[model samples]
Target: MANTMTSYTDAQIMKALLTKDFSGIGREFVDDVITSVKVGAFTGAQNLDKVSLPSVKEVHYCAFQNAAITTLDLPWGELEAIGFSAFAGASGLPQNPVFSKLTALSNGAFAGTSDKKNTDLRTISLPLWTGSSFSEGSGFSNSTGGIFAYCTALTSVSAPELQSLPTQMLYYCQALEEVVFPKVSTVNSGAFNYCSNLKKIDLGGAITRLGSAFMANASKVTALILRGVTTVPTLGSTTFNSTAVKSGNCYVYVPKALEATFKVASNWSTYASQIRAIEDYPDICGS
Candidate 1:
């Protein structure tokens, strides 16, 4: 199936989207990598090299569920949101969902946070994605763990705009080594559950809440940095029970001025001995 030139109008794209039929869009290219192409509503069967959606504001659910395009050119300047499962499947997209342009995502466009469960034939399903790496996912404010959950190959995350971590955000991503959330204040339930390789977290002063099992099974984390937080943030049950403590050296960093406050703050008292003041160490997030 070689697609030479059958340009589709925006109306045709929407029509194909509404009807879920993409016969009008010339299907497939032998190279499987496009230099530059513009259109929408790709049937999961097509192989594309590049896709550029310039005028699109919203990508409805499952629009490009399984197109084998190697490049994704989302209309970052104009796109507002992407519905759930908009790009599901292990190979649906060539890269991770690190939207480098979601600063304009003002209306809370979640981008269809997909899981590993959907069995629809429209999207290609496979085992774990081993090549995925984590970067600063920009332009998104989703509060669901579906963003990068279950990616066995994910190693690090550096989301500067994230103020809160959604439930099960990185659940079971055992390869995670570092997480840098400069502004994250809230951590929902099961946020980092079962991530065995996570070594450190630098939660700058803005943190306020830690939900249950947020770091449930992350056993190798040796450091937890909260050097900027003055007040003891709220803690849920077993926040770091089997996860960090299993390493026997999980150090919790806090401001020296308020070290006493964190030591006795309800559930925090459980790790009172592990708490240390950030003022005492310059290279804290690592140690």
Candidate 2:
């Protein structure tokens, strides 16, 4: 049942949202009033994207189980956190919404979507998350056993602000072919579990930890560049498990001066068969 009240204060607005009574409520009501939207507020809304709340600077744990949202226009600068499964099961969302100013995202924030054919979105771009950190089971997880298991059409990602990735961060994005994570440091288990199409991964020199990070995507990865890195991280028991690339088939490029050092390092010695000097591959490491 929807509330038909014509007038609503912020408290009433919060109540109306929590109770699923959005009768006379519209964008005008929100833009004219509501300044912050927190968790448990938009737990189950039907059509909120129709309204653009320029006045709202913070949106957290909103838009849960909603089936009819096509566009969301929020003031990202004023935004704080997008809690767990905030927009899960919103299968009809066509493209990735822009969140240029968001700082934090909890697990599975936008994970499970509807299984309707043609409903699978193509891309998700987060251009501004300079100070953000993604917790476990977050980013994009298909909690329902591959129902929304992967963003098959997702080919590009630009998350330079990411400092670390929790478990299964981009676990099953099979068609993902491009990624740009310039400052990532720690990678937990299953971080890029089955990204079969991403052929190259550059963990830059700042990487110091790898927690079973890449167990299954090793075959498709033709190049593994860890430039400027001098030390090897604590490798998991299955750090390079079940990789199809035979010895000499794939290349692991380390800093030129550290090539020999890596070959003799613990855990790294497992991939010594595929190891090479970074300078050997000018395409990846400029001469």
On TM-score, the leading prediction is 2
- What is candidate 2's lDDT per residue for 1-287, written digit by digit as tens? 22233455667566556666555456333453455554555566554544455666554553444534445555544555565555555544546555666766665555553252223456655666543433324444322112223455555566666666657666667777655566667666676667778777776636676766453664577776776465766666566775544434567777778788777778777778777887878876443
Model 2 misplaced regions, further than 4 Å: 1-32, 47-49, 62-67, 76-78, 91-98, 113-149, 213-218, 244-249, 285-287
Q: How far is candidate 1 from the true structure (C-alpha RMSD, Å)?
A: 8.4
Per-model C-alpha RMSD: 8.4, 5.6
Residue pairs in collision within model 2: 57-78, 108-138
Q: What is the model-wide C-alpha lDDT for candidate 1?
A: 0.56
Local accuracy of candidate 1 as per-residue lDDT tens digits, 90-180: 1434333444434322111122223442221111111222112222145433324454456566655556666666677677666678887
State model 2's lDDT.
0.58
* Best-matching candidate per lDDT: 2
In each prediction, how many residue pairs overlap at the backbone (N, C-alpha, C within less than 3 A)? Answer: 8, 2
